[model samples]
Every structure is written in structure tokens, then in C-alpha cells.
Target chain A: MKGAARTIGRDLGRIFQALAGLLFVSILVPLIWGEYYAIPALVVAGLVPFAVGYILTSRFRDAARPGKLHGMIIAALGWFCVAIFGSLPFLLIAWTVELAPPILGEPSQTSTLAAFTNPINAVFESMSGFTGTGLTMTDNEEVLPRTLQWWRSFIEWIGGVGVIVLTTAILARPGSGSLTLYESEARSERIHPSIVSTVQTIWWIFILFTFVSILLLWVVGMPLWGAINHGMTGLATGGFSITDNSIATYDSVAIDFALLPIMLLGSIAFPVHYLILQGDLRNLYSDLQTRWVFIYMGIGTVLLTVLVYVSDTYDSLFTAFRYGSFQFVSAATCAGFQTATDATNVALGRWSAQAQLTVVFGMVVGGAAGSTVGGIKLIRALTLLKGIRFRIADVFYPETAVRRLKINGRRLNEQEIRQEFEEAAIIAALWFLFLGLGTFALLIMLPQGEYTLENVIFEVASAQGNVGLSAGITGPESLPTLGKVMFLFNMWIGRLEIIPVLVTLRAVFDRGGLYR
Target chain B: MTVSDIPIVGDLLESGAEDRVFDSLLLAGPVLILVIAFLGRSTVTVGLAAAYVLFFVAYVLYLGVRR
Candidate 1:
């Protein structure tokens, strides 16, 4: 086959691999649920397509690793297929439950599932889970089966690391190129030459942090299970709280404070932490991205705290600061756990609007390039900031002169800086555009006017940022089917970092095979 | 790909201990506030945590400056 045709085939195969992985993982949930009755059918449903995909990909296994753009294509296609297959567990579970033990007098044989069983709602929940967005399809959280709830948060943990990364690591592939691909997808900085070593190191560090966080939570009087579960989700920056009220259920300032470090660490990039742990400590300072994330969090927290305090929502200034800081980190890391009622309380809830917007902006800025956290990322944010400053300087000077932008003390050429800004701006703009469209569409559908455009915007931004903050507008009962689907899509795209999914789709449709 | 095997940190310290200390304080200060606020579960807990966090943060800054 010609190079162009070969490229097309390669992209398709890659896309299928992602889809298959998602389906495979989704099927595991039924096994976890001990629903043995559903296993045979779920296996058949999931494995048939996967087997076909596996057959197709065997030929392409030796294809030279793809370029960065192609890398994006693989990531995007994988997320889309995963999101679609991720819905299976939701559909099967919801269908089985709604069918409810087969009506007694109706011959109690094998039963058919309901047509409007809200599979889309379940898909939204699953996508949100996998994408690390805490948005939900179900309303009454306490009523949902414990196994499924754990599965949702578990997906958040799994999705934090690319499914391929976990699979590749378990299989123990030590190739540098494979390592590069895995690091690239998870957006983690490479800590070692070999991909497997880097992945293992990252996981090791992540586990260590989680263990420490669990200890802190437990010391603060949280149940051991909640502590462990919260530690896992919190460190991943994937906010899927077990309790319906989120962190609010604890009602302990200690629990909120205990979570603060975990969330903050979650928001910072892993590479920075790795460097710090290595005792190179200077990377912590010389790293522009790390510095700015702290600056951003500091300013945001203080501002939001003052807003909360002045709004008279809480009696004490410390209470205001406590919740304010927690909300900021939650949104900044795109984690979205809330310690206070964000939507209903007119004062603190109202303050959340501003806090949520700031976080949406932060999510676009994101955490460090390698961290599990989502959004545009801090490096891009720093790059854009530097570029903007340089552009302003150029306006004052003559265009004929060379203008260089420096981040942390190193200089980058104008063209390189411009390219960085262009990438960041394009992704950020697209993210907001999707959020706007999703919010407007939801507003048109829902008859209830309880939410303002700001509220809808906040929720959509939350979904897009993969930040879980809600204005009490989402969940299975409140949001219609279409709204849930929209949110789910947003979370998936946001998690994949947008470009990959788009490139993958373009590859799928391009007649000229110009996807690259 | 791994920083553990590389020498990126070797170049970082050439900037000296002052720069390192400054950066650490900058990063640690906000984290401190967050930690205190989080640990203090109530309004009173927040107050106490805030006081403790503030004192520690100030001490860290002084140490950084001294370095």
C-alpha cells in the first residue's frame, strides 16, 4: 500500500485499539459487581468487536511509532471509543435494575430491558468517571449500588493514567519509544530513559502520595475506606466523592484541611514533585510553571476567600478562607470536590460562581504538563503569559527588532513562543466554545429556570475542565438525557486534551488522507 | 525521558541556595495556608490552623531569606 493509504490504516487501527481497551475495561465492572448472569453476554458483546480490532491491529504493530499529531489522534480516538464502550456497564446495570427481578405473574423467564432505560445518562456518568469529571447522571447518590459507585471512582483512578500506560506497564514493556508514547498520553514528564521505568516510577510516587494522604484523612477521623477511596480520587485530581454531599458530609474543617495538601499536590505537575524528591530542589524555583501555579492558587484563594467573607456566608473569616481555598484547588486541579453547598446557599453558593469561573480559567491553564490533572496546563498558560508580555513590548518597540520571550530565566525565540501561544489559545478557545454551546443547548431544553446562564456556563465549564463543581443542576434525576450526553462528551474531550480526538476524527473522514 | 537518570537538577542548583529557598517558600506558602485551613475542621479549627500555618510560613520565609 502507498504511504498515504498506510497512514490511514494505521490511524484506524490505533483508534480501534483505544475503543477495544475501553470496552474491555467497561466489561470488567460486571465481574466486579458479581453479576455472573450478565457476564457471558457482556463478554460476548465486548470481546467480539475487540477480537476484530485485535486482528486488524496485528498487522500494524510494527508500523514506526506515529508523530506527535498522530499521537494526538491515537489518544483522541481511544477516548471516544472508550467513552462509547464505557457506557455499556451503565446501560446493562441500569437496564437490569429498572427491569427489577422480572414481574412475578409475567412468567418470570428472561426479560427484555426498557428501551428508554437512560443509557445516555449512564454513558454520561461513565464518561464523567473515566474523564475524572465528577458530574453524575444519578441524583440520589445513596441509593446507587455500592459496587457501581466504586466502579465510577475506580474508572477515574484508571483513567488518570492512560489505560494503555497501565496495560503496557503490567505487560512490562521497557522500550523507550513506548515509554515516550505512554508519557505523552498521560502528559507526564519522563523520569527515566525507559518508558516502563518512568511509568513505574510515576505510579510508585502516586501510590506513595496516596498512602500518605489516606493516613492523614484517617488521622482526622475519616473511615478507613472513605480515606483510601478519597485519597485515590483526590490524588488523581478526579473528583468522584463517595458521599452524596461530597466533602460537605464530613462537616469537619480538619477533613477539609487534610484534603488541601492532597489536592494542591494534585494540581502541581508530577515532574516538579519528582525533581523536588530527587533533592534538585532548584527545579521547584526555576520551574516557571510550578511557580505560576502557586501564584495563581494563592491569588485565587485569597480573592475568593474575601468574597466569601464579605458575602456574609460564613460567620468566621477562617471558615470563609477554608472553603475558599478548598474550592480553588478543586477547580484549579480540575478535581471539583466541594466542601460547601455550591448551588443552593445564596451566599457561599453565589461566591462559588466566581470561584468556579476562576477555576475554569485555571483548568484551561491546567496543572503541570505531566500531572494527572486536566485542562490546558500550566506550561501553556505560562507560555501564553510570556508571549502576551512580549507582544506588548513589541508594540512599544519597532517590529523590525527581534523580540524574545523568557519564562523562568530562559529565552525562547519569537516564533517558538508564538507557536506555543497559538496552541494554547486555540485549545482554550475551543474548550470555552464547546462549553458555551453545551450550556446554551441545555438551557433551551430544561424548563426549570432555577439556574442562570452563569450557572449553566459553570456546569459546562466544570465538565469541560473535567472539574466536578456543579451548580446543583446535574445528576440522573435533574439533567435530561441530552444534557447528560453533552456533559459526557465535554468531559471525554477535555480529558483527552481535545486535539487528539479532533485529529482522529478528521483522519477517519478525510478523503485526501490529510489528517496528519 | 527520566529526570532521575538525567542531569537537569545539576544545572538547577547553580542558581544557588537563595534562589532555591525563594522558590520553595513561594510554593510552600500557599500550600501551607491550604493545609491549615483544611486541617481545622471547624471555624475554630480553621482559626487555629490558620494561625499555625501563618507562623510556619513566616518562619520558612525568614529561613529562605537568611539563606
Candidate 2:
């Protein structure tokens, strides 16, 4: 009993340290915003956790070698704390401070604190940004101060790399156990077995990508700040755009084309970056997930384009193909910067159900394995496909015949394939289950709102998959409070890949799993 | 982890140590433009904006430093 109590305290202490570091990094935004309220908020948020942690772990600081159990606890708790505290700036600014009233002919009102600054809305916005889900609960986002706006996109950038991954990568002592925990969080693709070196390599490559993206966006005529913000958000696969229409605001074919490469790059796993760094470019071709991702993207684009063309929505074939391909790639990569809205395109009565299905299918496949992008992941898709094939073959052969399915170059025995299938099945089932429940709940909450079954499912799926694509239902001024909360929970679970939430719940309820 | 392991996080630590005000200026180039527009100094805003971009380029280099 005593041991369990001590363990819980120790876990919270470590979690608090990680939260402090993240909060410290995030609080810089408010400082730049020059909101005087920010300082007190930061101080209170930082110190409360620091005090609790310092007191809890004061007795045995040396016992902080967090096992997987502790890792799960830290991740869940750390995310909860960050989201809660990250909301402070919004709440503080919304509540206490009143900037000068808007002058005439300004873009919009600078601060609609009365309408959008509630705790639920702030947390919803922060969660959407951090999870890279891009389901906003507020509108007139342009009116938000540049600093607060940056903070929203900035959360996505930080959340993209993940606080726990960064903590274990930077702070945790590298060892077999820590590496296992790191891999458990799915950050593992060890470019090098040395954990710190792996983290360094991954981040270094990520930074390189960010630089290239910024230069490309600038060259394509985006302003410098917009370029930098989009670069960070895009790399993280968190699609919070500065403009209200998202990528649609650019309206440039070049901009749309430029984002394809960026989204594709974002969708590939970090380990592939390591492989490329090690001068093994062929590994890209050899990767099962990479191959399937391309296949999915290509098939989805072609089919969606066909639907758009056949429906004759556009005067020109080029426009149909362009928008279709752009949206298909965006959904597939889970980089949900929409270049066109489904409603507008669909209202012409030109977009076929086939096109809609293709987009949803792309959303389900998501990006490559170990990516910042979300969904069941491409590797799971490939394995699940192979498992289905193996089952078909087994049905044809005698019951006694043994079958092994090969994915990429590796052949997996029945047990491995079954285990992989089970994992994929569980993920898919829970995903749709959550979507169904979320949609049903949203319908009950906002019965009079204009949400359709398809759009609601699409929004929930976008949140759950961490795919930021929307059917135009989610934005600050549009969605109800209950709808926003549902999306927030979806984003949090989506980023943690859902199991951590289950582990967290089980920890609270069935305490036996704490030892395991 | 030993004392030797402590410095692995040194890069983030060092990069975080730049003058906060200077760094804030570099980061706030966009915000600065909006402020200057409000202050009715569009010409000075443009010049400062150019300088801010230059400073930001230098800052990016600083980000790459291995101190």
C-alpha cells in the first residue's frame, strides 16, 4: 500500500517537471504579446506544479527511473497539465484585459473576449491546435492578436514533437528501459541505438525540413511570418492555418503544389529521415508503409479526380483534378489544410459519393508509420491487407497448411500476423466507435445546427485521426460547446494513439495493471 | 546518467539563452509591422521589417549553433 502511494507521488513529480519545462517554453508567447496578465498566469501555473512536484519527490529523487507504467502516466498527466495550463493565456487575456476598442475599417474586432474566452472554448482551441487536429471552436480567428495566434499554431509545433518524447529524449538517461518506453510511445525508429543521438538526429533533420519549407513558402510568395508558421505546423502535420480559409486563402496553384511535397514529406516516418541521412535512399522504396502510402495516395487521387471530373463540377477539367488531388493528398497525409470545401464543391451537385468515400478512405489510411500525422498508420494498413490475403489463401488450401504473410521483405508467421491484425482491428473499431458516439452526442447537443451525418463523422474522424480536414463544421463561431469538447477529447486521444487513455483509465479503475 | 550526460541537453539550454528582448523583436517582426501601422509610421515599419527579417536569418543561424 505504501509502495503504491509512493510510486504515484513519484510519477506525478516527474510529470510536473516535464510540464514545467513545456509550460516554460509555451509561456514565452504571452511575454511577447505584452499582456500584463500573462505574467501572473505563468507564475501561478508554473509554481503550483513546481511546488507540488518538489514536495512529492523531495524524499527520493534518485528513484526517478521511470518504467513503461510511469511513462504512460507521465504522458497522460503531462498532456492534461499542458492543455489545462496552456489555456491560461487565453482565459487571462479574455477575462482581465481589454485592449482598446477596434477602430473603423480594421479587419475585425481585435478581441471578442466576451464571446470566445470561456474555459471550455479556450481548452478546445488549445487542444485542437496541440493535437494538430485543426477543429477550431472560434471564428474571426484573424482578430486574435498575432502572439495568441502564434501560440495556437505553436502548440501544434510542440505537440507535434510531443512533450514526453522530448523529455525522454533530452532528460531521461538513455538505457534499454528508457528506449523501450520511448518506443512504446512510438518515437523509437532508432536512427541510432544511442537514444540521445537518435533524438538529435531526428530533430536535426526535422529542423532542416522546416528550413527548406520556410524557404519554399517564401519563394512561393507567402509572407515571412506566415511561411515560418506554416512550415512548423506543416512539418508537425498540425494544420492550423493563419488565414480563416486555410490553404484556400493562398488561391495559388503554385502554393497548392508546393504543399503536396511538404505534406508528403511530413507523412513519412522520422526513421526514414534517419535512413536517408545514413545515405540509404533505397530504404524509402523498400519500406512497406512508404509503398502503401503512395499507393493509397495515388489511388485516392485518381478515383477522387475521376469522380470530380465525371460529376462535371468545374468548367475546366484542370480545376477539378487540381482541387481533387490537393484535397485527396491533404486528407491522406493527414495535413488537413483544405484548398476547397466539400459543401461548395458538393453543392454544385457534381461531387459524387465516390469522391467523398475516397476522401474518407484516405483519412482512414492516414500517413506513414511513426509520423507526426495520425490515423491507424500505413504500416497497420499494409499488415492488415496482407493478413486478409493470407486468410484467403488459407481458406483455399487445406486447413492443416501453414501460412505466413510477408510485408515488405519480412515474412510474419501466423501469430505475428494475427497479433498485428488484432491491434489494427482494435484501433479501427475504437476509432469508429468514438466517431459514432461523438457524432450522436453532437447531434443531441446541437440539434438545430446545420451539421449533417457525413460532416459530423468527417469532423470527428478528422479529430480522431489528427487529420485537420473539415467539412466546414468546425470553427470558433460555428460549433457548439459540446461539439468542441468532443473534438478536444478526440484530439487528445488521437495523438496519444488512444491506448494511453485506456491505460490511464485502467490505472484509475483496475489498479492491477499498474504493476504490469 | 552521469555528469557527462548532463550536457546533451546543453544545446536547447544554450539556444534558449539569447537576449530575450532581442529575440522577442526578431520573433515579433509581423506584430511590429501591425504596431507600426497603428502608430502611423509605415515607412519606418517597412525598414524595420526588412531589418527584422535580416536579424531573423541570423537568429536561424544561431539556432543551428552547437554551443
How many pairs of residues collide in each model?
A: 20, 5
What stretches of model 2 exceed 4 Å from their correct place? A1-12, A26-60, A98-116, A341-353, A511-516, B1-67
Scoring each candidate complex against the real one, what DockQ results? 0.04, 0.06
Which one is best on DockQ? Answer: 2
* Whole-model alpha-carbon lDDT for candidate 1: 0.65
TM-score of each: 0.77, 0.81
lDDT: which candidate is best? Answer: 2
After superposition of all CA atoms, the RMSD between model 1 and the true structure is: 8.8
Q: How much lDDT does each candidate structure score?
A: 0.65, 0.68
**lDDT (tens digit, per residue) of candidate 1 on A329-381:** 78888777888674323322365455556645655566777777787787777
A452: Cα error in model 2, Å: 2.1
* Residue lDDT tens for model 2, A370-417: 777888788877777777777877878987887788877878787888
